[model samples]
Target chain A: MSIIKAVHLRKRFIVKKKEPGLKGALKGIFAPKKIIINALDDVSFSMKKGEIIGLIGPNGAGKSTTIKILTGILQPLSGEVEVMGLNPQKKRAEVVSRIGVVFGQRSQLYWDIRLGESFELFRRIYRIPDEEYNANLELMDSLLGIRRLIDIPVRQLSLGQRMRGEIVSAVLHSPDILFLDEPTIGLDIQAKRNIRKFIREINQKKKTTIILTTHDLGDVQELCPRLVVINKGKIIEDGALDAIVHRLAPERILQIDTDKVKKDFTYPHCKMIKCEENKMWISFNRENVSASKLIAALSAEVRINDLQVKEPDIEDAIEQIYGEG
Target chain B: MRCAVQSWFEYPLEMLCWIIFIPLYSFGGLLLLKVISTQFSEIGGWTFHGLAFFYGLGIVTHGLHVIFFFAVWHTNYMVLNGEFDRILLYPMNPFFMFIIQSFNIAGYIDITPGIIIFTYACLKLNLDWNAVAILKLIAVLIGGTLIRTGIFMIAGAIGFFRDTRNAVTNFMVDFLAYNTTAFPLNIYPYGIQVILTFLIPVGFINTYPAQDFMGMDNTFSIPINLSLCTLLVGIAFFLLAYGFFRFGLKHYKSTGS
Candidate 1:
C-alpha cells in the first residue's frame, strides 16, 4: 500500500533581481525586479509502506523542495500530497504526527541541554506513552549505543554522536514514516556504517517507511531497494536500484590471470576491455552472455590461474544517471 | 521556558551580565528623565513623578512583551535562517509552541527596575491605597502588556510576506511602539496622538492609564474608564494581532533550499 503520494506538485519562488554595484542597489530600492523560479515542476512519486526509497538528484533539482512539500513545511503552488491517508497541507498536524524528519546540516536538539533532556522534551511534545518511549529508547540504545552519549550536552558531542542522537530523537515517538535528508552527509565511514545499521534495524523492527535524500550513492546502494531519480524539478527515473544500475551500466568486467600469455582474443558478445601480459580484462553484457560462459570461453584460450568478476559500481551508475538526466 | 532557563545557567557570566545590564540600561533612561525634570519641574502639565510613573508603566509593559512575545520578535530572523521549518513540523499549533518557547526568563530582569520605580513614584504621589486602585493597576499592567505584545505580533506577521533582517519589525516595535510609550502623549500633536492611540495603540499602553490615575484631562474626545478601556482594547488588539499572525502564516513561504 502506498503510504505517501504526490501528484503534479509544483512550486515557484519569487527572487528579487539585485543588480550589481551601488547604482544597481539604488535602482533596486526604487524599482525592484522579481523573477519567478520554478522550484518544483510537475513532480510526482509515491512510496509504499515500509519501503526504503532514495530520492536522488543534482543540487537545485528540487529534491529538498519535494521533501519539504511532503513534510508539510512548505505548501506548493499547486499540488496534492497525501501522507498516511491525509492531505499534508490541509491536515498538517496529523500528517506531521505520523512522520519524522531530520536535516543533517541542522539539529533539532537544544544545544546547551543534555541529550536525554532533549529526548524527554520531545517525548512530552509528541505525548509518547511512557512504556513505548522507554522501549524505543532501549531500541535506539541497542542500535546506536545512544545511552552512553545521553548525559553529554548536545554542543559538546561529536558530529557523529550528535547525529546518532538526532536519529534517535526523530524516532522516539515511533513515527511510521521517517524522512532522512542527507542523514550521513559529514560522517566518517564508521559513523556512516553505524547510522546505516541503525536505519536497517528500525525499519526491520518497526516497519518504518523511510524516504532518504542524499548525494551519497553508497547510502542509496546500501539501504534503498528502490530509487526515484529526479532532475530539473521532475522525476527522471523510478525503479529498483539494481535495475537503474543495469539500465545505465549493463556490462560487467571480468579480470583473468593466466599462467601463460596469449594473443588478444575476442568471442561473440565478449570484448577484450584490456590485456597486459598474462592478465586480461574482458567486458561482456550479462543478458547476452553469462559470466560462466565468458569465463569458459576465456579459459579455453588461456591457462587460467586466477579469475575475478567486477560488477559496475553504483557510484558510476548514479553519476551516469545524473549526467544523462 | 525551561530550556531557556537551563541554557541560561550553562553560562553564569553571560546570564549575570544579561540580568544586570537590563536594569542598568533602564537606569540611564531614568537619569535622562531626571535631567529633563530638573530643568522643567513639569512636562505636559504633569509633575516629574507622574511622568516617571508613565515611564515605569512603559518599562514593565515592554518587559512583559519581551517575556511573552520573544518568538514574534524573532520571527524575521527565524524565517530568514530557515529555523521556522522546525516549528511547523511539531504536532501542535506552531504559534503556541513559539509563544511557549519564547517565555524568556531574562525578560524578568527588565521588570525589576520598572516595578521598583513605579512603586517609588506611587508612594511619592501619596495615592490612596484603595482596593479598587490596586485592582485597576493590575488590570492596566496586564492590558498594557497585551497591547505591547499585540503590536509585536503584528510586526512579526510581516515575516510571512518577505525574508527580512528585521529592519521593518524593529522599526515598528522598537522605535514607533516603544518610544511612544516613554513620555506623555498629550505633548504630541493631535494627528500623532491619533496614530499612537488608534493606529499602533502605544498610547493605550501607558498614557491613557496614567491620565486616569492622575485624574488629568484626557486628550482624546472619548472618555475612558481606565479598567474598561484597557480590558476591552487590550483583548481586542490581541485578538486582532493573533488573527493577523494566522493570516500571515497562510502566506508563509519558508526559506526553502
Candidate 2:
C-alpha cells in the first residue's frame, strides 16, 4: 500500500513587500503590499511502504513545501494528502508519531549535551520501553559506529559525525517512514560514504520507507532508486534515476592521454575539450561516434598512454533539468 | 520530567552566572522599592511589605520563565532555523520536547532569592506560615508561574504562524509588566479595570494575590478566577495556535542561507 499520497497539492504565501529606510519602514506599518508566492502548484506523487525515493531540486524549487505537506507539518490550500490512510492535517499527532524527519544544516541533537542525552530525551518522549531502547541503541552503535561519539557534546563533533548521529536519532523511535532533507550537506567524502551505507542498510533491513532530498547527486546515485524532481513550484520529472540521467544527456566524455607532447590536436567528429600537450579530453555524441571509434581516431595521431571514458553522471543530468549555471 | 530537569542544569557556569545576576537585579529592584516605597505608601492603601509580596511574586514567576522557558523566547528563531522540524519527526509532542529541550536551570537564582525576600517580608510582618498560608503561597507561586508560562506558550505559538516575532512579544511583556507591577486594578476606573481582568488577565499576576494576602475583598480576585478558567480556554487557544502552526508549516520554506 502507498504510505504517502498527494494529488494536485497546492500552497501559496502572501509575503509583505518590505522597503528600506526610515520612511519606508514607517509607511510599511500602515500600508503593506503582499506578493503572492505559489510555493507548490498541482503536485502529485505517492510512495509505497519501505521505498527509498530521492527528491532533488534546485534552490527555491519547492522541495521543502512538499515534504511539509506530506509530514502534516503544513496544510495545502487546495489538494489532497493522505499518509497511512489518514489526512495529515486532521491527524498530525497520529501521523507524526509514525514518520521520522531530519532537516540538514540544522542540528536537532542538543548542542551542549552529549549525543546520548538527546537519545534519552527521544526515548522518554516516545514512551519507548527499556528493552527496545537498549536494543535500538546497540543496533545504532553497530550500524553507525556511534559508540565513540556518544559522550562527546554535539558542539565538538565534526559535521559528518553529527549527521551520523542525526540519522540514528531519527530512527531511534523505529518509525516506519524516514524523511531526510539534505542529510549530507557539508561532509567529507568518507563521511558521505559512511552515511550512504547506513541509508542503504536501513532501507534493506527495516523496509523503512525513505524520502531523501539532497543537493548531493552522489547520494542519489548510491542510495535512491526512484527520483522526484521539482522546479519552480512544479514537478518537472519523477521516475528511475537512470531514466532521468539518460534522458538528459546520452553521451560519454573520453579523455585520451597521449605520450607525445602534441600542442595542436583537433578532429572534426570529436572536438578536443582540452588539448594542452599529450593529455586531451575529447567530447563526441554517443550516436555520432562510439568510444571504440574515438579510441581508434586517437591512436592514429599519437600513442595512447591511458584512455578513460566517462558517462554523464547524475549531477550533469540534474543541472540540465534545472538549467542551472 | 526529572531527567529533563537534570539535563537542563548540566551547565554549571550558566547556573553560577544566573545566581549572581539575580542578586544584581534584586539590588536594583530593592533600590527602586526603597525609593518608590517612600513616596507611595500603597497602591490603594497597600504597604511596603504588601508591595514586596507583589514584587517578589513577579520576580519569582519571571525566574520560572527565565529558567524554564528561555528557549520559548526564541520560538521564531527555532522555526526559522528549522529546529522545530527536528522535534516534529519524533514520536512525541513537539511542543513538549521543545519546552524540555530549551530549559535552563539558572531560574532558581532569582527565584530562590525572591522566595527568601518574600519569607523575610512575611516574618517582618510576623505573618503566619501555617498550613493555610503555606498552601496559599504554593498556589500563588506555582499557579502564577504556570499562568505566566501558559501566556508565553500562547505567544510562542503565535511565532509558528508568523515568520518573525518582533515587538509584538515585547509589547506583551511590557504591557503585562506595567499593568501587574505598577498598581492595583481597583484604583483604575471601572471600564479599564474590567478590560484588564476580563480581556487580558494581567491583573492576576499581582493585584488579586496581594488582595488575598492582605485579606482584601473578593473583587480583587475576579481576574485570578478568570485566569484560572484558562484551564479550559487556554487549551482552546493553544489548539488554535497549534492548528495555525501546522498550517504555517506547509509554507515553511527553509532558506539555504
Candidate 3:
C-alpha cells in the first residue's frame, strides 16, 4: 500500500507588495497590489509503504510547503494529497496523530521541564497503554540512547543530546511515517553518524516509512537509497539515487597527473573532458571503453604518476537537474 | 497536571517573587481605598466599608486571573515570534499548554492591601459577624470570580484574531461605570438598567453582592443579576471566542523562527 499519494498539489501564495514611506503608505491604503507566487506547481509523487525516500531541493523549492500541506498545517490551492488513505487537510487531527515530523532546529519539549516530563505528557496525549509505553520507551532509549538524559532539564542538554531527545518525543508513540527536515543539520560528525545509524536502523528493523528533506547530500546518499529531487516547486527527478546520478552526469571522471603534458590522442572510445596544469580528466562509459585499454593507451604516451576514478557527486547531479530543467 | 505544578517549585526565585508581590499589592490597595473612603462617604448607596469590601474582592479576583491565565495572554508574544510552532507540533492543544506552563504567584502582591481593607471594613462597619452574611459573601465570591475570569478569557481569545489585545482596558472602564452608579437597577432609568443588566453584564461582578449584604434593592435583583448579562454573556463570549480562534487559525501564517 502506498503511504503517501500527492498529485498536482498546487499551492499558490500571494506576495503582497508593501509600499514605502508616507506617500506610499497613503497610496497603499487605496490601491494595494498583490503578486501571486506558485510555491508548488503541479507537483505529483507517491511513496510505497516502508520506503525510505529522500526529498532533496534548494531553498524555496517547496520542501517545507509540501510537508506543511501533508501535515495539514496549510491548505493547497488545488490538487489532492492523501496520507495513509486520509485527506490531510480535511482529516488533520487523525492524519497528524499518525505522522511524526521533526524540524531540525525546532525543540518541541518544554524549556524548563525534564525530558521525562515531556515523554509522560506525550504518553497522556497519545493515550498509550503502560505495556506499549514501556516497550516504546525501551526501544527509543536504545535507538537514540537518551535514557541517561531523561532526568536532565531540556535547557541543560547539549544540542546533540537535545536533538536525540526531540526525536524520541516525536516518535514516542511509534508513528508509522516520519518526516525529518535537515535532521543532521548543525551536528558534529559523531552525532551525525549516530543519527544516520539510528534512522537507518529504524527504517530497516521497524519498517518505519521515512521521508527526509535535506540539503546535506551525505545524509540522503548514506541513509536514503531512493531519491526525489525537486526544484522551483517542481520535481525534476524521482527514482533511485544511482539512476539520478547516471542520468544527470552519465560518465565517470578519470583524472591522470603526469610529469609533462600528454599528446592529444582523441580516443574515439573515451572523451577528454578537461585538461589543466599538467593534469587531464576524461570521461568514458564503462560499457563503451574498457578501463585497462584506455589507461594503457594514455599511460603509453605520458608518465602517469597518479590515477583515480570518480563518480559525479549526487549534489552536483541534482543541481544540474535543477539548472537544465 | 501534577508535573506542571511541580515545575513551578523548581524555580524558587519566581515563586518567592510572587509571595512578595501579592502582599505588596494588597497593602498598596488599602492606601488608595483609604483615600477614597475618607473623602467620599459612599459610592452609590453603600457605606465606606461596603465599597471597600467589594473592592478587595475585585482585587483578589483580578490577582487570580493574572496568576492562572498569565500564559494565555502571553501566547500572542509566543505566536508572533514563531515560538508557538514548537508548541503546535506537540500533541497537546497549544492553548492548554500555555495555561499549564507556569503557576503565577506574581499577582499575590495585591492580597496584603486587600486584607487590610477587608479588616478595616469589618472593624468600621460593626455589622453582625453572622452566618447569613458570610454565606452571602461566599455566594458573591462564586459569581464574582467566574464573571471576572470569564471577561478576561473572552479578551484572551480575541487575541487570536487581532494584532493587539488592548481589551484589558475594559477592566478600568467597567470598574468606573459600576462603582459610580448610585443604587442597583431600580433607581436608574429603565433603559439604563436594561443595558447594564443584559447588554454589558459588568454590574453583577460587584454590585449584585452590594445589594445582598446591604439589604438594598436593585432593579433586577438575584435572579436577573446572576442570570442575565454575567453568565449568559460570559458563555456567549466564550463561544464567540472559540469561533474566532478557529477562524484565525485558518489564516495564521506561523513565521519561520
Candidate 4:
C-alpha cells in the first residue's frame, strides 16, 4: 500500500531583486524589483510502507521544498499530498504526529538543556505515554548508545553526537514515517557508518518507512534500493538505484599496465581516453564491449602485465544527470 | 518553562542587571507621576492617588505582557532565520509552541515594582476591597494584558508579509503602549482620545477601567458598563488579532535554506 503520495506539487517564491552599489540600495527603498522563483514545478512521487527511498538532487533543485511540503511546513502553490491517507495540509496535527523530520542544518532540540531534557520535552509535545516513551528511549540507547550522551547539554555535543540525539528525539514517538534531509552531512566515516547501521536497524525493527534526501551518494548507495533524481524543480529519473546508474552511466574505464610501449593501439567499440608512460586508460560501455573481450583483444596487441576495470559509481551518474540539465 | 528558567539562571550577571534595572525603570514613571501631581491636583479630573492607580495598572499589565507574549518580539527574527520552521514541525499549534518555547521567567522582576506601587496606591485611595472589586481588578489586569498582547501580535504578524526586523513592534511598544497608555486618555485631544479608545483600543487597557474606580462618567457614549468594557474589548480585539495572525500564517514564506 502506498503510505505517502504527492501529485503535481507546485510552489513558488517572490524575492526582492536589488541592483549593485549604494545608489541601487537607495532606489530599492522606494521601488525594488521582484522576481518569481518556481521552487517546485509539477513534481510527483509515491512511496510504500517500509521502503527506503533516496531523494537526491543538486542545490536549489527543490529537494528541501518537497520535504517541507510533505511535512506540512510548506504549502505548495498547487498539489495534492496525502500522508497515511490524510491530507498533510488540512490535517497537519494528525499528519505531523505520525511522522518525524530532521533537517541536517537545523536542530529541534533546546540548546540550553541537556539532551535528555530535550527528549522529555518532545515526549510532552507529542503526548507520548510514559511506558512507550521509556521503551523507545531504551531501544535507541541500545541501538545508538545514546544513554551516556543524554546528560550533556545539546550545544556542547559534537556534531555527530548531536545528530544521534536528534535522530533519537525524532523517533521517540515511534513515528511510522521518517523524513531525513542530509542526515550524514558532515560526520566522520565511523559516525556515518554507525548512523547508517542505526537507520537500517530501525527500519528492520520497527518497519518504519523512510524518505531521505542527500548529496552523499554513499548514503544512497548503501541505504536506498530506489533512487529519485530531481533537478531544476522537476523529477528527472526515478527507479532502482542500480538500474538508474546503469542507464545514465554504463561505461567502465579499463586501465592497462604494459612492459612494451605500443605507438598506436586501436580496437573496435572501445576508445583510449588517456595514456602515459607504460599505462593506458580505455573507456567502453559494458553493453557494447565486454571487459574480458576487450582485455583479450588488448593482450594480443601489447604485452599487458596488469589491468583493472573501474565500475561507474552513483556519483558519476548523478554528475551526468546534473550535467544534462 | 523549565528550560527557560534554567537558561535564565545560567546568565547570572544578566539576571542581576534585569533585577536592578526593571524596578528603576518603573520608579522613573512614578517620579513623573509625582511631578504631575505637584503641579496640578489632577491632569484629567484624576486625583494623585487615582492617577497612581492607573499608572500602576499600566505597569503591571506591561510587565505581564512581556512575561507571556515576549515571543512575539522575536517573530521577525524567527521567520527570517528559519527558526519558525522548526516550531511548525511540532505536533501542536505553532502559536502555542512559539509561546511556551520562549516563556521568560525574568519577567517576574518586572512585575514586582508594579505590584508594590499598586498596593501602595490602593492603600492611599482606601477603595473598597470587596470580593467583587477584587474580581473586577483581576479581570482588568487580565483584560489589559490581552489588549497589549493582541496589539503586539498584530505587529509581529506583519513579519510574515515583509521583513520589518521588529521595527513595527518597537513603535507599538514604545509609542502606543508605554508613552500613550501610561497617562490619562482624557489629557490628549478629543480626536486622539477617540483613536486610542476605539481604533487602537490602548485606552481600554487602563483608562476606561480606572474611570469606574475614580467615580468618573463615561467620556464616550458607549452603552456597555464601563467596568466590564475592558474585558469585553480585550476579548474582541484579541480574537481579531489572532485571526489576523492566522491569516499571516497562511501566507508565511519560510526563508530558503
lDDT against the true structure, each candidate: 0.86, 0.74, 0.71, 0.88
Candidate 1 residue lDDT tens string, A232-314: 88888899988888988988899889877666687888888787877888888888998887778778888899999999877
Per-residue lDDT over B104-223 for candidate 3, one digit per residue giving the tens place of the 0 to 100 score? 655455445555666666677676868866765655555555555555445544555444434453454345433422234444677876777665555665566556555577765555
1 or 3, which is superior by lDDT?
1
Off by over 4 Å in 2: A19-30, A253-310, B1-11, B27-31, B34-43, B61-71, B124-139, B166-168, B187-192, B217-257
Candidate 1 residue pairs in clash (backbone atoms < 3 Å): none
Rank order (by TM-score, best first): 4, 1, 2, 3
DockQ value of candidate 3 = 0.30
Chain A TM-score vs. truth, each candidate: 0.89, 0.87, 0.92, 0.98
lDDT of 3 at B60: 53
Candidate 3 vs. true structure, TM-score: 0.82
Cα RMSD for candidates in order: 2.5, 4.4, 4.6, 1.3
Name the candidate, 3 or 4, with the larger lDDT value: 4
Give the fraction of reference interface contacts each candidate recovers. 0.71, 0.39, 0.20, 0.65
lDDT of 4 by residue, B110-219 (tens): 88898888888899999999998988888888889999888888888888888777765676656888888778898999999889988899988888888877778756
- A36-147 in candidate 3: lDDT tens per residue? 8788899999999899999988878888788877777777889999999999767776877787888886777877889899889888877778897898789877888888
Please provide, for model 1 over B75-186, each residue's C-alpha lDDT reduced to its tens digit, 9 standing for 90 to 100: 7777787887788889999889888875787788888899888888898898997999888888888898888888878887888887667877687578876678777899
Report the Cα lDDT for residue B85, model 4.
78
| Higher-ranked by TM-score: 1 or 2 | 1
**Winning model by lDDT:** 4
Candidate 2 Cα deviation (angstroms), residue A51: 2.0
lDDT of 2 by residue, B40-154 (tens): 7655666778767767777776677677766666776777676666666555566666777657666667677777767767766677668876666666655556556655555
Q: What 10-residue stretch in candidate 2 chain A is worst by lDDT?
A: A261-270
Please report how far candidate 4 places residue A272 from its true position, in Å. Answer: 0.8
